[model samples]
Target: MNIVRKLALSASMVALCCTAASAANLTVGFSQIGSESGWRAAETSVTKQEAEKRGVTLKFADAQQKQENQIKALRGFIAQGVDAILVAPVVATGWEEVLKEAKEAKIPVVLLDRGVDAPQDLYLTSVASDQVKEGRVAGEWLAKTVGSKDCRVVELQGTVGSTPAINRKKGFEEAIASSKNISIVRSQTGDFTRSKGKEVMEGFLKAENGGKNICAMYAHNDDMAVGAIQAIKDAGLKPGTDILVVSIDAVPDIFAAMMKGEANATVELTPNMAGPAFDALDAYLKSGKQPAKFIITESKLYTPADDPKGEYERRKGLGY
Candidate 1:
């Protein structure tokens, strides 16, 4: 080959090689919302597994359930020039500025399992379960289980002002709105924690005549339901029998509770939010295809008849 032709070909090959390497070395930063619950822990583990499967570099930061920590982590990711970012925001608002910075840096941001109140153009997409549907499913189960009987329900809600808390409560209320026989007699925020759930349930028990007047307990998440189960037992009441227990987020512990006849039903909030977020990111990065603004995950309901032991075994090893 002529020297000029050979040089041109070699340069082209080097450019191709560099492009391929860059494509293979895609780096993403993930800001997790701390290990506040078993479901959150499972999300972190699943996100890492998904990143590894895609051969992507994942830079993970735990926000410790603080918005400031999340903001700091996002800024760091932007400064590092990550190809993309995944954030399970601790709260819904106050994310516009940081997301704008990421947009200015030309880094795509995908919300995981939660969303922020930012402009649509600022984020690639949000991957989360239909939290309202989750709550509705739980409420429906309770309504069906009661079957026209007058049922007074006590609710253990998640963190106040959070998206999940708000939407889940809305969904449950919608579900039971037409059921004149069922009513939420008492509701309190459990902060999505087992300890807080227990404490809140204790107060409800005291306020509701030692749990006798409560026919059912509906928790926004399973962690709270599990905690409430202990509170029910402490109050010398049978949980699943005396007070039907229903909740969202079918974590393994809830399944265990179901197995022990402590919990009646639970709706699943799958922790594989990152899997869809990564899929959307890959499509956007590879072909410039825009995913839908919201990618809703499954909201499956489980009861004791669904073989809680099998579900527990399936999820027990997923770092939950």
Candidate 2:
């Protein structure tokens, strides 16, 4: 471990010791990647809710979007000798070494919402949505909407080289492969942040004839899509009518945008990933029955016609 990891581990050990129970009830430690987005915050909230609902002792650690923090948190959990560990990895690589440590400690580590590039045996299972299908759904929606009309697209990507970024891009490309009328004219990474999304979209508008050449915008997440919508309007162009904005993660803000006729569509990426993760952990702990290696949550495309107002109301209080 590095100096940062060592420092973080030492600090977290005190907190974990105070909070983590030593009794016989199931004890699980979770290392989250921080609340960088609405969806991430929702996931964290739901994870805590699920653990409470199931009467499990949950030790939560916020990694603040750093790999070193996650490593530190995992080591702290292992030292605590918690029954299990959960990790939402910050990145795909650089996890094998820490994961091996978890396995040697006999802790079944479950991954939430994201994936790691390490060997499968290091973790018990991963609970996430089918990210490629999410991109495909968004692409298909754009393709069907455009029909035979020529359309140029600009993509706002997630963290470059991340699994969702790679898979979602591949899936969208696959869906639009046969559509000669629709071409992605520009693409850039937005780092899956609202500010970065707006900044990138501003650049795209300036480069693509002030948003005239861009017929549609496909963002890897709804936060970026929401920010891009602002960029579209600031450029004196209607977002849904001029650019046909579409993205993933059906966050409440996106639905609110749809209700205002700003965003066209969004593919739902449920934040209740920990609901399934906890269920799998419960089963495994109680019966020694291993769950499937991959627990895929469902993804659905939501449009204005699907009662965007009602959807917004329903999701507004879910920590999004």
Candidate 3:
């Protein structure tokens, strides 16, 4: 071959390889709903790890419990032209416009741990635990324990507009509706934070008659439940005995509380949603296939009698 022809061929091959590499280096932008709970932090950790393992470039944005921040981050990701986007929405509403924009850009969006109210076709898939079932599990456990005993419950809800808070509350209420003995006397948002939970629980403790009318406490997450335990202690009440406590999210602290008999029951919301979300992303991106509208994860209920010490030890090692 002539030297000039050889040089031209080599240059053409180099350009083609560069183009292929650029196409293969999928850039996925992820907007997390801040590290509010142990479960949320663990989800973030696993997501980053998963992206690294798959050799995909990840651009992360922490919304810090603000909806405006998430909107801004979504816009930034759109401007940057990410191949795909993953959002753990801070709340369920006010996502229509941003999602529409992403869809117009032809970037697939995957929801993690929460579902959006937008049209399902706008987002590629949602990978989340069934909040309704989780709430029902807690309610069933409580009902079985209480039986026909009269129960006045104080509810510590999650963030107001969040899916977990809304769906969990609905499911729990539905499950306990037929049981006349189980009634929610007081309910308020704890914002899914420990401090908020403690503060709200304190108010509940100070309610008329020294919270004597309250028989149990229910929190949306384990952090809040643990906080409620502290409040119960400060109020000079026996947590597990005098006032039963139940919550969702089987975090390490909840396990510890269970071991100490300070908490009664919890429903596990595993933080491993990121791994399956990424798998869905990989499949869709590689094959041009559309994934399911929702991928529901299975969860379980935990109690003190369910190997309390082992549960505590195992959760402690989970880097919660």
Candidate 4:
């Protein structure tokens, strides 16, 4: 071919390749449960940051702690034809229909920080800490702390139907069962909110003879524990002194609380689940490979002794 004709053909091919590359940009839709707690906020922030780094277009929907809202949002994402969907479910139930819709649409869904009880093949992957393990850790710590001493504990649970609340309660009860001296006197749902945590704690205080018999408090998350601390103080008892407090989700606020002697211990549930979730999504999208059923992440127990100052500084950096 002539030089000019060859050049023109090459230019056309390059334009077509560029169009394909631009079309390859992934669009992800994320349905957040809500920003009810520090841990939830951190998860949102981290997920947004991760999406930005990956050049992914994230269509975010805030479910506002309602299952109906989440279902609506997921359907909307499916209708929009998003490449993938990530959801931090408010609760584990009532997800089958919407997830089936997404599956029928051939859109992969990733569950972050929470789980849904459905067919194993329903979701692409789940990235979360072992919530049951976190609860067991908290219970083990409490059992060791109050060894051989009859201690009346109150549980500030998460959202009533949420996986963390259910699994955490079960694991905690199992761990403390061997130690008959430790008993949970009051257990109520806090809805994973600071205000709810405080409100429920107040009721526990009143139920336990004006908070006099309450020996310790076990909260589902740090935000609730922090709120419970305020209630304990309001009831004229020195928290972390008169009644020890332990909880899950070691967000920055929890670390600060620990340093300030407001909280006793917390289990770390890292908010970086987005990375692994997206990694699975990438693999699934690239080669049509099916991902694992559950992607269990690691967790750690945090106490005052574990880099107290460093933990405080890290949490402070999180803008909590």
lDDT of 3 by residue, 1-320 (tens): 23235334534544554464555667788888988766678788778778767766777778889998888878777877878899999888999999999999998899998877888888999998999999999888888899999999999999999778998998788889889999999999999989999999999999936767789998999888888899999988989888999999888888888888899999989887877888888889889877788898877888888997887776675567
TM-score of each: 0.81, 0.80, 0.73, 0.72
For residue 313, what is the lDDT in candidate 3? 77
- Residues 15-87 of candidate 1 have per-residue lDDT tens digits of 5544556456677888998997777899999898898788777777787899988888888778768799999
What does each candidate score in C-alpha RMSD?
Answer: 8.4, 4.6, 8.5, 8.8
Q: Lowest-lDDT window of 10 residues in candidate 3?
A: 1-10
**What is the lDDT, from 0 to 100, of the residue 274 in candidate 2?**
81
Model 1 segments more than 4 A misplaced: 1-25, 65-72, 75-81, 91-98, 159-163, 199-212
Go through the candidates in order and give the clash count of each.
0, 0, 0, 0
